[model samples]
Target: MNETPQKSQELKKVAECLYRNGNKVYFALVKVRGKQIKRSLKTDDMAIAKRRLAELREKAERLHGKENKNIRFEELAENWMESIKASLKPKSHDRRRVAIVGLTPFFKGMPVKAVGFAEIDEWRRKRGASISARSHNIELETLKNLLRYACDRGILMDNRAEDFKRRKQPKAVVDVLTRPQFQVLVKALYASPIAVASGAAAMVEFLAYSGMRVGEAREVRFCDVNFETNTILITSGESGTKNHEERTIPLFPNLRNLIQRIKAARPTADANDRIFQIDSPRGALPAACKRAGLPHFSVHSLRHFFASNAIENDVNFKVVAGWLGHSDGGMLVAKTYGHLRQEFSATMAQKMTFEGLSDTPPTFAVVRDAAA
Candidate 1:
């Protein structure tokens, strides 16, 4: 016989603890006072049951620390994740959630205070074998932040995850498409009926011309582009810009034409409509590469292509940096694109000459003083 959840005695709703009791009511099966208890929500309405579930879970979590000071790592991680999930971007929140999921298998029942550098080091060494240093570092950082949060709340005396060493990663080489290769890609895009109709060619040219990331490009709306000024506003999206700052890039002639073509095709599109309806630009790029018979390049390569061309053309580094939405003015641009500038310098180097220096000594070098 299922009894209704009492409205009195502070018996409240919560998460992770409810079930349907046949067709009559929802049952709350939760741990209270270290013992599992089953109570009826007495409502078949899912919304009411869910509201009660959240309340129950929150109440239980609040009492967990007071009931037992030595909480398991998994339990503490769940509590910590809930506390900070709202503050993180969706992608970032998903990453941290995954890190927590990966963590529980190793530290599931370990007491928070018992976890230390040795355990973290072992996890790092084991995890590093399967993933890149960057990913490994992120996992370790996630664990470190969780433990740091626990420390701040007085749940633990120290943050042992902090002592785990991060792997040093080398800077990756920026792969860019040469002018001839880019031209080949464009030709291939136009040649293929499917590619041309899909608008992949226009996207490639847009990225190459504007230096915007594929994500940023995809987020751009019709209203974001200003034909009169020849500029496009890059705004934050679901994951936000890399640095979380919006910027505008000048609409170079090629890019401007591409946008114009798109607008002409969709004259009825509202200003709020996304310029490109394609879901993933990179997924569509490989076909063009296969047809072009050139090495497959990611969409990001087009950004590098833009930067390389800008540097080769002697565009001011700061201007290029701003166009690329980099906050460091041109420092990172100089480091990454400086070699192209050097290539230009090398060409100029060949043209240099000391006008006064010659194999033959100056005509009057042997100053025969007639007076002497």
Candidate 2:
């Protein structure tokens, strides 16, 4: 056993211990044949420097996936966010920022893969009544999308978010104002400031008359209207559309006149300029409502009003769907507005009641038959 020390046969000393900034560190350089290939296993660990280099060599030989061990979740998320930021629109990017900030606290130290259903449930439970169910769902969906991005890049093992379920939304009826109610609201808007009523009088009138979405109505420029054809083109916008496709909607004669009047009143009206140029709908809409002495009806109510009026007037559901720029005619007209359609059916039933009674033949009297 003592004879083994006779030949400490020229160990290659491939790995070396080094000191930098007074911290013990390890690095190894390996050269093979004429290639002079080099590999560095840089670590803060001095004792394990040689061992770390060997592991790296084995990993390289296997040629599996890259080893970014000790990578932080924040790092992967940051990397994924670059492309996402570029892809998202300005408003969308801002919304995503809020969602991310709300979600990050729950999973700060955890690996992306470790964020599964159990963690989501725990987070939701702890959140309690602070956030609405719909808001909670939005934040949850944002997390899911991030996980999906990681999975696509092979950075995550699985999208654990898929296992989580959304909270059920209560079936509250969406708000809609009747025609007379909306007229009262508009009167209140008339007394409000430009900041309070910025283009809303026109917006409400337009959406109610033309059945256009708020986003679509806001994007129309003066040039988009054709006086000769009497058509309004909802093709141009700063952001993409709800349906992501443009459509030419017939301008209701009344709506066209209202828009014209609004344009005439505006100091800055250009052929190519945004028709409704204001900071935000939120600024003016509420003030206008207060001044008009009317309830603050969201502009989206105009959409609901349009649907109700359409059903009442017996306008075909498909026609209403197209005017609203919905891809699914059935969903837009039938599903959400089925109750309105029932009112139409009720009107028809009234018409047939008297007619059915009159159309029936009178029965012969039993007394007359007994006398015979």
Show how many residue pairs clash in every candidate, following the order shown. Answer: 10, 2
lDDT of 1: 0.80
Q: On residues 52-143, what C-alpha lDDT tens digit does candidate 1 reach at each position?
A: 76766554454435644688888889898889877776778889998888777778889886788888778877777998888888888889
TM-scores across all candidates? Answer: 0.73, 0.70
lDDT of 2 by residue, 1-372 (tens): 854553332223433422222233344444332223244445666557667766645433432144643345666667766778866767677777787778778777776656667887787787636898888888778778887777666555447778878888676575667777787776766655664356655666777887777777788888998888999898748675675688988877777898788777875778888777652355556776777667777767778888788778888878888878888865757777888778778878877745436666889866656557
Give the lowest summed-lDDT range of ten residues in model 2: 14-23
C-alpha local distance difference test of each model:
0.80, 0.69
